[model samples]
Target: MTSGLQQKNSILILDFGSQYTQLIARRVRENKVYSTIVSHKITAEEIKKQAPKGLIFSGGPASVYDEKSPKCDKGIFKLGIPILGICYGQQLIAQYFGGKVRRTREREFGRQELFIDDHADFFSGLPGNITCWMSHGDYVSSLPKGFVSIAHTLSTPNAAFASRDRKVFGVQFHPEVVHTARGSEIISNFLYRICRCRPSWEMGAFIKDTVSHIRQLVGKDSVVCGLSGGVDSSVAAVLIHRAIGRQLRCIFVDNGLVRNREPEEIKTIFRANLHMNLDFVNAQNRFLKRLKGVTDPEVKRKTIGDEFIKVFEEEAKKIRRVKYLAQGTLYPDVIESVSATGSPSAKIKTHHNVGGLPEKMNLKLIEPLRELFKDEVRELAKQLGLPQEIIHRQPFPGPGLAIRIVGEVTPERLQVLRDADDIFVGEIRKAGLYNEVWQSFCVLLCIKSVGVMGDERTYENVIALRCVSSSDGMTADWVKLEPALLGKVSSRIINEVKGVNRVVYDISSKPPSTIEWE
Candidate 1:
């Protein structure tokens, strides 16, 4: 789906392998213009093919001094598109075009106050003493002829530069990340004033366009969506179904990790409101069989992943030549997985917590939400009139309870963890916390801890409850629950769930700890 403004104001972001490059695309989309992240090595012909209104160079973890550091061909500059260069991007722009760059004795990182000079086009509407995220080891010492320094930090004088005549802008700091206060406004300024893009990106128009796109892509051929009942997959299914009616088939395999009653709810919605083909497969036995005795987290992940693909392949084969495999792959995965930098994007964290997919699957992929962030997907979900239960459901990894259950996959353990998790989420919902928090769930630790219950010493599994506050799942801080609320949750889980003797809350955030333990 494309918005009118999105159609007209398309921006091509050349990836320099910056970890936050996808974050940049997310920020730009939030501003109401569609942005695409492409590798810096993308050919001039490819850029011409996209026909972007503006171009942006993403910052990378590389220094310009490195021999193999990423660089675009000189032809990119002469493309006549309004160009924006971030950190490494800025350094590349200057160094290649007769500017000087030097490694800093003391690298600038983390939060810094930006001092914007009136001459800077990128900071036209931005305020002085603005906060921005900086993560660069090298600094731009000089600018090419005709270019002017527009902004700077105390440590870095050439923080920002612009050549209004050429429509070229560069920033040494990242405006895509939240660490930069007013980052969104700075991006909007570039999109609206400099790039001259109209704010035509909207969710409603996107839905209409996506519906049309689906009709064209899957003409007369049946399309199958691998629904996990999560926001991403479900939203994709709804949009496609709206576009093509019964031609869209949603197959939900109960891989046995979903929360209580999710499969049933999913079936009811798709059958009643969506009027699409809904198939529910209880593949719990097959998944558990494949995961039996797998203790290593990585091994378990691979096992489950392989098994899921096999199951999907088998189901697709039975369907007699399924043309497309629809997924909920988001923009972050597309950006990070296919980085512009020479480095493998696999080094970065995954958008989905699930294990990698087997490469042998032959079905053509159809991912409707591939260009959107989690929040944007939600906006589209709301526009589609999906029930709040489905739309506002807390984020759950595709791997399901497998990651939550620290050890081997077994029916008994799955049941125990599922029950505890149900109580945990149920209480959170009872307190009106589901929509408020980004993710909230319970983890069943593999090790059994001793506890005293009434005069008896019981050896029981310990369950850890995790809840975090975040916009996207990229980075997060642990949610702060009141003492009363925590007490109630802890009491209920221990009392109601068998085999779970003790309950503890996970207070660690994403940096020191990932949302999931496994």
Candidate 2:
């Protein structure tokens, strides 16, 4: 969704390059109130134009005293909106209001206990002591001019401060993270009790509004949607079809890089079950040819993305009068592409549909799910009456198996990884862990090792198994699969799939490592 279509009475979250900034937006949106994220550099006049009922300052990695640290316009405090500061945001508030802030000798990270001092509305209906997730090195040394300390921790004497009359609040801990127990409740208290925002936003409303918007935008023009048979694309195709039935046409490209039999399965499901106006393109040869000797991850992604676009362009020409191109670009894609918050976020890998899409394409872009998270898209899929299989299917990247293959994109490597991934997922489903994990896949590492098979010497490539548990794709932790299940998967892959000898599970989290290997 575009910034123009954001609902009124929304909360404006000023991002300061925090990794958890998106989580803050997710929490607010979960309360049924619309929320938008912008850079901390957003001026007061710009924020005033949005007319948000509340303002939130997100945590960041930079220190307030740093030379290049991000800061907000001081006039925002005069907007008369309820303002809540978190972590670095809390430091900004303190530093802005004549309070002292410095690097603490004792740093607070991970889970910590917070003791409430004077009960305030911000912590209403909560216990006196609660566990909170803390990730800050700097602490507020003194309270702001008109602020009173409302909570404290052993390390941070002023863990939370508030000025009820000014409608300003600051918390040293991150309530947006799940590690912070009662995190959602804290956000709800702020949304409902302080800001007085109405819980009026829902997926049903979004569908109705988006359909009307799409209808008005593409009155008589036909649109072509890129369908990957994943939840995001499928939902977008259905939603757009609902908007303009005959005007929407979906193109599913088999880029020779998907899982085994994925192309055939997708064709069957779309043609028979969903009954969509679909066209399937088998451009595997073209894709594999273009990626013949490519080894760089970014180069591989761009090559696949460009090839997909070319295929879509060719298909669009066959169809008559297609004026728009639709994609299932989600919020995480937008955030990672280039900070939606406008703050300086280190670019993670470039998603094929996000930054890899050609900017000079002939058709105008339509991304209905741009402002939504993955879970929200699933809910929308359910509202659209999509089949259970399509609704619950785990997310697959647009680059398909191209990214999953670590070093090179080859037919042999693709087949090997696909076979191994299928077995991995089949076992996950068999163990009743498929739906429990956010994403689970196997990557074919380029390196080879010596092994013993049938008492003889054998050399083959190693396969890495990656499974993560996450609320949104933004942040994730490795899923702790049972030892028996791991043993079964490893045994099955080593014995069944031909080129692999070793199986290793990745235990890294999202902060240091992304879900994808390449």
Candidate 3:
């Protein structure tokens, strides 16, 4: 039996520090097949125990030729499980099999025309000449024994290769990326045709399994969850309550940094609707006092995290016998919060939920949704019979608008930001563009500019509108709002948000700029 919750016929993806590893998992889930991302250091015994239908190696930033490149157990190949390697994963396989791989003088990092051949069924039903997205610097120079080229690019002749007899496949170009035309179909071929996996991964089954797992992990212990009215925490609280009814207690903290009327809405949804054991904490002054004059993003996160732990600990004292703390910590949060599997991509930001708690808190953590993504959480929330409002709310930081304020956090600044953000989001919903984008919010910049308000020279804060389209929070692109919508939002912000005179839109993408300005 698998030690973890890896179900039958699921695909196990080994992460080699790839930024797109989570994307690969997301693509697999989109096909209705379960996918789990494990560390590359997983042992052969572990793979055999998991008994997954197939395995996929995620493309990583590391070069396989390097001495410190990540690796996996070689003996798993003998397990006869079908394997698909992408980019660095392909190079790792080629090198292990005595194939030649050399760094090209010119790095390949963009779109290329990939020509298919009749050697393998991986490209079956796809066009002979297909467009692919390539982002690897190294290429396989020679084929391994019994492996034949299935596809070729102008620069990368061994763009794709497979050993049909051994049920092994490798693709130089990322088939998981949407930029690659028919990329999803190519992956489907490997999944259905080669691995013989059925669409067994569904939200209904996931909720059941998670409920059972939570009941077992937290037996007879009182579990306390910090419910923020967001889909993640709300879903988590509901899920846990189902598992251990009445044993779970949800705490809704009025941290003073949340949006206008957010606490009231959260109260209505969870306390009134769900009928769960809910505690409302008024720690507005506590949080505001600590956050005064804090400018550095990291320090601000730490300060909030520290304060959160202190508050939770105090709450637990009143609740009595609270032994577990359930958080809505998702996979992307864990990935971005720290170096995942010692990847080259180290800590991006310290998410308050993941890094907020003290090392030795009285209540242990039980993050039932820690391994899931935002979209998956929404799916589960919908299946759990949650309202559309909870399922489709924009992603809010654990630190709330504190990170969005971009400077010293104060009550005066917080109120101004709350008004502006509320207007931006309300208008987005009114325009019917709310569901079109992954996240849309307003960031209050500390800087001020002189402006003429009815012929009077006034200096006021600027609110930057950030709207991005993304499958997960991993990589995001700016949403190009129509000029009319922008004009409406800008005009409303300048006129309505009292302290704000200027409204600007953020057009930067994730790599160069994160979703949040801070």
Model 1 compared with the native: what TM-score? 0.91
How many backbone clashes does every candidate have? 1, 0, 0
RMSD of each: 2.8, 1.9, 2.1
lDDT string for model 1 (1-518, tens) is: 56555656799888877777788888888887888777787888778767788999988878888997888878888888899899998999888778999998887778888888863456666667788888889999978999988888888999888888989888999898777899888888898889988666778877878888889988888777888878888898888888877777788889887777888888888778767788888898888888888887767766776777777777777675478878888865555344433533435443332226676666777888877889999999999888887788877776788888888878888889888888888888899988999999889897898988889999999999899998876667899998898899889888888887888889997644677787
TM-score of model 2 (CA atoms):
0.96
Q: Report the C-alpha displacement of residue 68, candidate 1, in angstroms.
A: 0.9
Query: What tens-digit string does per-residue lDDT give for candidate 2 at 1-518?
Result: 43334457689999998878888989998998888788899999998888888999999889999989998999999889899999999999999989999998877777899998876578888999999988988999988789999989888898999989989899999999888888899899999989999886788778988999999999999999999989999999999999999899999888888888788888888888878898988888999999999999999888888888899899999888899999999998877776876697777778888878887988889999998999999999989999888888998988888888888788999989999999999999998888889999999888999999899888998999999998998878899989999999999999998988888888998866888888
| Model 3: pairs clashing at backbone N, Cα or C within 3 Å | none
Which is the leading candidate under lDDT? Answer: 2
- Model 2 regions lying over 4 Å from their true place: 1-6, 106-108
TM-score of each: 0.91, 0.96, 0.95
> On TM-score, who's better, 1 or 3?
3
* Error in Å for residue 41 of model 2: 3.1
